[model samples]
Target: MCRHVVPASASRKALLLQALLLISAGMVGTWCVQAITIETVNKASEVMCVRYWIPNEVGGGCNEVRMGNKWDIQVTDRWKAATVWATEGGCGGAHCNTGPPTGVTQFEITVDGGWSNDYYDISALAGFNLGLTVAPTNPTCASQICTSLSTCQGVVPGGPDRTKACKYGSASYVLTFIK
Candidate 1:
């Protein structure tokens, strides 16, 4: 009679591989959720409606499958915004009427999942007019001093403060992600 026995290490490797396969197949295992908050300081006189979306992000706004231009760096999750001010408007959300405009405003959203090891951005675009500051907020962000996008974006995250410009309805801004 002939018999064969599998080594413990070999069995362990097989089990690990199976677990990986299951996770990749979306069959089992859990995903990590990350939260991102945006504080929109409305320095403008008009009560503004803030709108934003994370493109190519693994979330409801983007609703894209796990993907990356460089690799399978699936970093981010289902994102939904919670208005801390009187009105909410973004990606087809509604706006609530408010009597007066508050100089300071806030927006909060939770990303369902993400890779903490990687870096992502939370930014506004060419259309919005809300002064912005990221927190762990940089107090000296304005002083960083950049006359161009390349220079501004080149600054470390949270280093470029566009809140002053955005205060009075500046069309464009450069903001670092507030982790």
Candidate 2:
């Protein structure tokens, strides 16, 4: 029986081709995890209650954000949506809810997972308890801001208006709660 051997040049070429294919298929060099940092700022005159959670997970409950302070949530390479609420009162209060209910301001964000673009929006459809603004670090991405309850769009029966999107791994965001 005779044994067959591959030449060094041919082996290298084959390996290079395999690598290129993997990269193109988004398998090789795709482990570069990108993150979007969402900074929630409390510009209200009093302490604000905040709650946040990703899809299929329960939030840690209402956390108080002191006036002029900020809370940051970093979303890494995950294909889930993160929802945050800023309310005048804590959870179980007259003004807040564990979920996005009426009278609670909500900010929803879906970070890029290397395959799709990032989407973000501020919704007053639940009724406005606080003014909200979602500003992305990328200038190319537009900001979603609603500063007045009367001027703010109410429930559209579906979703928020003026949803903004940015390139994958492009920008972090700042969600500000104004007075």
lDDT of each: 0.31, 0.70
| lDDT of each residue in 10-83, candidate 2, tens digit only | 87779878778988888854354676677889997577778776766543345678888988876675636667
Please tell me which predicted candidate would have the highest TM-score against the true structure: 2
Candidate 2's C-alpha runs over 4 A off are: 1-29, 58-62, 89-98, 113-115, 153-161
* Steric overlap count per candidate: 4, 0
- RMSD (CA, Å), candidate 2 to true, equals 8.5
The residue-by-residue lDDT of candidate 1 on 66-144, one tens digit each, is 1111111121334323222222222134322222234322322333323322122322322222333333233332322
Q: What's the lDDT of the predicted structure labeled candidate 1?
A: 0.31
TM-score for each model: 0.31, 0.70
